[model samples]
Target: MAGKRSGSPDPKRHLWVLGLIAPMSALLPSQLVLYTKLEVFWWIGPIIVLIVIPVLDWVVGEDGTNPRDEDYELLSKDRYYRWCTYMFLPVQLSGLIIAAYMWSGDALSVVDKLGLAATLGFVSGIGINAAHELGHRVEHLERWLSKIALAQSAYGHFFVEHNKGHHARVATPEDPASARMGESLWEFLPRSVIGGFRSAIHIERERLKRKGHRWFSVHNHILQAWAMTAVLFGALLAIYGLRILPYLVLQAVIGAALLETVNYVEHYGLLRRRRPNGGWARCSPRDSWNSDRLVTNIFLFHLQRHSDHHANPGRRYQTLRTSEEAPQLPAGYATMIVLALFPPLWRIIMDPRLLEHYAGDVSQANIQPRKRERILAAYEYRAAA
Candidate 1:
């Protein structure tokens, strides 16, 4: 097997890490099932995730770097990608089954409630994050898995908008999800959620127009996404009554927050240049986040290999790699995302490097290809004004 070869040390490491993430993910929801009360456990989930994980990561985190050359080729292949898609199925289905059990049990203690919340949250992660990677795959089955994962998270339209719009505009001012240089996470979340949905609707509408289909047709992804959310809501109401509505909302909110936190970290200080013709530059590996942390990368199904994802959108997640020239995060994505939440600290650490890269100026020289020209044009227009 590719993972067992002499030159495949890091791939072996990645497999080990993947093994760890799979079980941890499986266990998280089960742990939540032990919580006694839903309300208390709800807060505990964020505390453990946001506070506890970050502290532990900071203290014991491995340094990030490019994977070994031999491992890179082995890791960046279709088989691994397919494996990632396959793994998500069990995690999602398991979480769903456990959630159904918890809902059926009714009025659990704090520990049991916590277990349920954690399980749902982890399941949401598996569905959304794993699907986010799979959705980019060129293979039909992998693509279908991606959509199923998104539906599980109740964010089905993300599969459409993310591929069509987000990739095209990422790190540019036009991207609502791209965090501006000094923007806080608090400021970015609402804007991104609202703007991203709007952009998705617009993209879908244009796509439908091209296909001679009406915007309101059942084929529209946005409408379909809304319908899915409604169906989930109705199911909850039917199964657990009105009391469970708040928990469902909480789950969705946590899932959305996790997605946005990742967005904030991935392109925190990256920018594209404008072309002479006023177009943005095409994305390169350097335009997105890169990390080679064996643990988190595996846990995230190689999502830390983001530069590859942006460079080759159709590549499967398991096949993502650390590009030679892509800017790398200092550690895993989870650690960076935590750092991003504290803007002052983030700026203190990152601004100097960014300013050095731009030589204290924000000109065409610092931007790339077509993006450079557009940026220059914008500058010139401003000067004229």
Candidate 2:
């Protein structure tokens, strides 16, 4: 979740209504892909994942507009969007089970095994996306479902860190989930993963302390989710044996990586200003980049509209709107993620925008500490010249 918005709307059923179908696309092929040879089936999910979705993201352009304020009120009560996420639980679990069955029992080459593992990872990542939506609500059922989905990726503690720590600290220097100005994806990955875990523990500890509970107890939110993950994976290991272990780990890593990539993209190089009162400025659309590309918007539950999601963290994704003030991404999450892997290319595309975002005032930006002096000198000098 990333930026700002004001309510607006159109009465005509907007295309975003179709967003419900997007997550299911990941599940639709589970059975069909299994019917093909391991070589062909293994590649099917990834192709639809890494290639087709991005292409659709490009062709469909963007819908920067939001539903009318009245429409939003109506949309919020519409059970369709909420139920869509609920439906995600079954498809995600079934897809994983079927993919594992095919991989474990069906004789396959090492290449196919890895490829199938990746395919399952793609679905698991999509499941996490759904869980993210569910996890944000105050409702008990939504929280439970969100944790269950997280179990598939073995990244359940994300539910706690994200809602508690990330939301409060996002776009600030202190937020590990927010990528630093000059930090490469390679550098951000390990930091975000390890630091986020630690942050979750810290946040959960503070929360329990407020409630008069000890941090070390299994009752801590982080441990509760992690225990769920353990039980889920333990059951898999018990039944599937050693061969399935690698498949599980590979998929889980990719799923978690998917989450990190989004976090990296969501707030890359953006920072909230520090107040004289020692508080960070309130988050605005300008503090986050946004992409309203049609395909990724729906596919990710309007998460590409990072600005609105951050501005209204509790706003249902269906009603999340975009503001013109946010930094616009050059492409959707799928494309940006690929670019992120190559730092030089990403820097070329993003660094100038980062400078431009701060109106060329390097000091206005929250920069990477190690290179802060070098960056400030170069960019600040360029602006002066």
The CA lDDT of each predicted structure is 0.65, 0.79
Show model 1 residue runs off by greater than 4 Å.
1-4, 7-10, 13-80, 103-115, 225-233, 362-385
Q: Looking at candidate 2, what is the lDDT of residue 144?
A: 86
| lDDT tens per residue, model 1, 271-385 | 8867899898788886776777665655676777888788877655544567766766766777777777787888676655555545555441323333445544644522213
Q: What is the alpha-carbon lDDT for the whole of candidate 2?
A: 0.79
TM-score winner: 2
Q: Which candidate is the best by lDDT?
A: 2
Q: What TM value does model 2 have?
A: 0.90
Report the Cα lDDT for candidate 1. Answer: 0.65
Q: For candidate 1, give the lDDT of residue 328.
A: 69
